[model samples]
Target: MLETPYVAVDVDVLDRNLAGMAAVARERGLGLRPHAKTHKCLEIARRQVEHGATGLTVATVSEAEVFAGGGFDDLFIAYPIWPSPGRAERLRALAGRVALRVGVDSAESAEALSAAVGPLDVLVEIDSGHHRSGVRPADAVRVAEAAERAGHRVRGIFTFPGHGYAPGQQHTAALDEAAALSAADLGDGVRSGGSTPTAPLAEGGALTEIRPGVYVFGDAQQVELGGCGWDDVALTVVATVVSRTGNRVIVDAGSKVLGADRLAWATGFGRLPEHPDARIVALSEHHATIEFPAEPPARGDVLRIAPNHVCATVNLADELVVVRGGAEADRWRVAARGANT
Candidate 1:
């Protein structure tokens, strides 16, 4: 058996996830730019491309450079980046190598990126109720106009419906995304809409592209949001029980391995795929305390714990063991693990 506190990927389920999202995008007449931040593995990124992803979406210039170096040519930095001199130079080099695009939320960003990268393709970021990095939808046109005047090409608009992560808010977030993109209107450019939560609601009306990261590896948060089934989870931390109490078992995998990203609405720190009722009530540096409904498992017993955020968990691991049909297939490195520039 592999060592405890390591991330494992079931290739069968991973393939299922890849194809399912590809089919959804195709049926909806939308382009699939599956976000690479989730897995950050070159092997998974290759599979996504083979499964019909038009391009890859990354969060930072460094991540884009990593994927570009791996020969995944087409890429978009979905986050609204404030490019420092070093990052700008990197972006320039990456743009020279691949078909690169980035998200812009303000006139200053538009002007600065153009000056830095020399007339790159930029998509204005709309808020769409996320209230994060993006600007108001009604203000997207001004940004687009500023982009064009600044010597950059305004491709269209994109929004991250992050609020969809909450239970029963998927549809509303999707609708808000559509409405925001529609209101942003920069002629007939590619309108990008996000997130795994609202991906299923894409109906070909507003969005031309969908970027969903977590769908490739279902998580506890996805489970709680009704976005994916427990069986659909492709990645999990394989942990070994280290201590046993009356009704609780402490596992070797904890916040350090599984990531400490417990959503406010999340039931627990993590979830047990085998025992649905089990709750990972607490997590220490290298231990996860799970409260099981029944008798706690014996020490040394191995359990798979699905994390609340697959992206963060993936970022923490150095490599993910790939398994197929219940046997070890290969191991993939997290190539973009610290590409957080």
Candidate 2:
């Protein structure tokens, strides 16, 4: 078997994580709209739907289009997208094909979206604690009312508790989400909120849907932050050691493939599979300098690296080899890998 620089997916672990999340959503009576931005593979998306995901959540309209064309009938563009004239036509065309839901943060954008795609299902994004693109909890009603006035239907409220990614913040973030949604008066509608880090702590009360992406492929940051264990890591970059020194070994994969997602608390660029303690200290476009604690990699040895963030790492790959029990079983193409627009 040829092994050098390749993206590999551990099918067993990935299936387990998908099933676990689906079970969580079922138990809570909430919708599981797993973010497609994680893997972006049609095969993985099919598995998610098969495991009982209500629909797919995407970060961009391009991603939504890709999945919709690939036969995913239900999708939610979770970002507060300001659709231009052309993009608006695209959105309307997309809505005609699938059950497309979009996110809106302000009255102006809502009005614009309503004018473009009349009477569409929209979610008023509430800023729980992320301070990203969302209206305040107290302002959610105002935005929803505006969208309603523009002839759009307000489905419910949604938020991204991205602050929950940090340690000791998941509980607070979840509380914020509950309070925000409650205050927003999103009654009998879908109050959606949840990140990978906050998924376990997310209660079933107000949140009717959870959009967790990274849990499918546990990253180094997830492992370091205690969100997931090393065994839960389902994806890895298989790269061959090209250069070797006393303590530093350079690999053939770098930021282009592994991605540059070093959080403040992250120990290094990535984690080596054989020696989890080893740190990928430096990363260039095509080279990664790994500092080994012990058992330095040989010049021709292939090293599997767990990325700091799996979502970004996945966007870099064109395709992924689905491996089960140490053997490659299938290949999945990343249908929306570069669908950034």
Candidate 3:
């Protein structure tokens, strides 16, 4: 038997998720470059590629290096990376090894990227209501031109539309992303857009590629947003009930393993798929306090809890116990875990 407080991945559910997303991308005629930061597992990444992923999107250079070293050469670091001397050297080497692209949002960053490593493929980041690290649509051209001046080729523009994460905002955020990309004049570069919530509605709206990270393993936030059903959750933290009260059951798995990323709109710290009404009310380092709606689980009863954020939860784990046909089939290393740089 596998140990408790470990991350369990249902391979059947994972394959379904991958195939579903691939079918959608094929139907939409959009390039599917899923964000790899969500799983951070080489096994999962290979499966994604096998499922017709055109390439993989990543959040950091370190993640890019890991994947590239693993022979997944087509990588796009979607974050607006500031090129320090060390990072620039790394980027330069990665470019030499693989087809590398990086995001840039400002002339200053463009210069830094170029000075550190010249003649790189750069995508200008446009702020489509996220108000994050991206330039506005109107300023996209300016940044693109600045990138050209800094010796980088402007390949396209991209946006996050992160506002879609909230309730009742997916369609609106998608519209905003389309509108922003439509308004931006970045020559004939590819227009990339998406967040997992906005990806479905992103078709035919100035997007050639979509980078969604969360669909691989539906999380509590995605469930609350109506993005996935309870059965769609592929990753969960396996824990054993250690204590019980009236309606409270304590599990050995907590934030240390499951992560603590409760969104403002989230119902609780995490969720119990086996008992949908159960709420992870409190989470300590190695304990999860769950409030069950019905009879509490007796001590020693094992359960699985879906994390609030699948990405954070995956980052916390060293490996994923991949279950196929209801058996422990394999253990996939979280190869890119803690690659936050």
Score residue 257 of candidate 3 by CA lDDT.
94
The per-model lDDT (C-alpha) reads 0.92, 0.89, 0.91
Model 3 residue runs over 4 Å out of place are none
Candidate 1 residue spans exceeding 4 A from truth: none
Residue 207, model 3: lDDT of 89
lDDT of 3 by residue, 1-341 (tens): 67899999999999999998888888888899999999998888999999899889999999999999888989999999988888888999999999999999999999988887888998999999989889989998888888998899889999999999999999999999999999995767789988888888886648888999989999889999999998999999999999998999999998899898988989999998989999898999999999988889899999989999999999999999998877899999999999988
Tell how far residue 173 is off in model 3, in angstroms.
0.5
TM-score per prediction, in order, is 0.99, 0.97, 0.98
Over the full model, what C-alpha lDDT does candidate 1 score relative to the true structure? 0.92
Residue 115 alpha-carbon offset, candidate 2, angstroms? 2.0
- Model 3's TM-score against the true structure: 0.98
* Model 1 lDDT tens row, 134-235: 989889888999999999988889999998989899999999999998988788999999799999997588999999999999999999998889889999
In terms of lDDT, the best-performing candidate is 1
Stretch of 10 with least lDDT, candidate 1? 110-119
On lDDT, the stronger of 1 and 3 is 1
Give each model's clash number: 0, 0, 0
C-alpha lDDT of residue 91 in model 1: 86
